[model samples]
Target: MSEFDKKDVPEERIGLIDLMRTIKVVPLVTLHSPEEAVPLARALASGGVPIAEVTFRSAAALDGMRAIHDQVPEVTLVAGTVHTVDQARQAVEAGCKGVVSPAFSDAVVDWCMGSRIPVLPGTATPSDIEKAYDLGLRFTKFFPAEAYGGVKTLKALSGPFAEMSFLPTGGVGFGNAREYIDLPNVFAVGGSFPVPSKAQRQGDWKAVADACAQARQLVQG
Candidate 1:
């Protein structure tokens, strides 16, 4: 059985897509140190956004997720930048509520589906979206959003994939956040914009909180 089955999880839990829609913004985070996890999570919560997509881009990813899960339980955790099935399993073991891949990995998506774990496979083109759609997935991520045409691309996609919703990430910042979030098909925006690099490097939790609040405002407005 999967780790999720080993635990007593609620049967009627909120789906990740619905949760993301409500939150409006999902902060893509990369932790260089495990010690920053709790405070970073706390900051996110204080800023009115209590969700984090901890990317497996560093050695500290699992440890950081563990700390946030154990100490800052209110912050919803999603494993990001996943590339393989093993990493997906390790993410669930670390207490991630969902999984996000930078690209549509057949193995990872298949494993998540079999394990009943929410997965957002990345898509930058119609073909990628079509593959996820064929798998009965209506929610997916639009990666490198700006580079691939940003709002214009999403607008064009809305025509053919009207039933689909997206979490637009990459090149998403305050300036264009409102534009992305305003799109009817965009469920939420994702980026490191909410977690300022300088502030995080300095361990300035308050600045992080403020940045998150500002992002939340921008999207909500």
Candidate 2:
């Protein structure tokens, strides 16, 4: 691989991607309440998944991230559903190691690049992927994976973007997760099925952990 290839991404950025690949799954979490943040993070860690892509979909996102960062510091946290540069900055301030957006936003992507923070901007089409490549990013999030042809789409993309790898999210769950993970072009899978909604809402950490464990097994199998 050339120095500019995915294998040659900056050392710090490589570490982030390595962590994701090691875990094989990133929990796409939406905090319903700030109080559940620490416990949820711990549950994920106990379940063998220690990473979170906390979306900015809810109001508790920032405080939730802070609680996780301050309390359960072991879980690798990243911001998700980010639509603006301000959200990206807030995520970083909340101790997130990186940021993820549902769509490609120049301002957000540029801010992370300028700040030297690892980011995975969403790309659902060939044009979007090319734009990400033009920005010198080798890793990107493939959003609405199932909606836009899922595994078949990823396989087709491999031909044109041989050097680029993806973190496929949306419409991904236990039934189809292994298929995505098994793909050579996918680095990791992102979705919320690992942290069951009822488990999180009722503070049933063990149930959450069990779900996560099952997800980990799916990837291993």
Output the number of the TM-score-best candidate: 2
Note each model's CA RMSD in angstroms.
5.2, 1.4
* Residue pairs with backbone atoms closer than 3 Å in model 1 (clashes): none
Q: Rate the local accuracy (lDDT) of all candidates.
A: 0.91, 0.93
Model 1 poorest 10 in a row by lDDT: 4-13
- C-alpha lDDT (0 to 100) for residue 218 of candidate 2: 92
Per-residue lDDT over 76-173 for candidate 2, one digit per residue giving the tens place of the 0 to 100 score? 99999999989999999999999999999999999998898899999999999999998889999999899989999999999999988999999999
TM-score for each model: 0.94, 0.97
For residues 1-118, what per-residue lDDT tens digits would candidate 1 score against the true structure?
1343224333322366667888799999999899999999999999999999999999999999999999999999999999999999999999998999999999999998888898
> Model 2 RMSD to the real structure?
1.4
Off by over 4 Å in 1: 1-14
lDDT of 1 at 166: 90
